[model samples]
Target: MALMITDECINCDVCEPECPNDAISQGAEIYVIDPNKCTECVGHYDTPQCVEVCPVDCIPKDPDHAETQDQLRAKYEKLVAAKG
Candidate 1:
């Protein structure tokens, strides 16, 4: 599943830099995660770095954008290919 930053986010700006996919960004009120770019760190780490570093535990799996691990991996590959 792709992760999402909830309204509970404190906007501390910690999660943005931790995202390997560059999916996290500062929204008007809190941090936001782009589902299209979110791979749950499947290609870069064993765990989601944003969730690991989030101080308020606001990051959670996005039920609206549910995806399997294999899907996440494919998304990661697509993102990498886009960059090259």
Candidate 2:
């Protein structure tokens, strides 16, 4: 599943840099995660980097954007390909 930033987020700006997919961004108040870009670090890392670095643990599974491992891998591949 893609990860999401909850309202509990402290806006510490710590999670943004940790996201390998560049899915996290500063919103009007709290940081937001772009589900389309989020892969929960499937292809880049063993775990979600944002969640690992989040001080408040506000990053959690996005139930609304649930995806399988294969799906996440495909997304990751597409993202890296686009970047290159």
Q: Which candidate's TM-score is highest?
A: 1
lDDT per residue, candidate 1, 1-84, as tens digits?
899999999888888988989998888888899999999999899999998998899999999999999999999999999999
Q: In candidate 1, how many Å is residue 67 off? A: 0.3
| lDDT for residue 64 in candidate 2, whole number 0-100 | 95
Instruction: Evaluate candidate 2 by giving its C-alpha RMSD to the native, one decimal.
Output: 0.7
The runs of at least 3 residues in candidate 2 whose Cα sits more than 4 Å from the true structure, single-residue gaps closed, are none
Candidate 2 global TM-score: 0.96
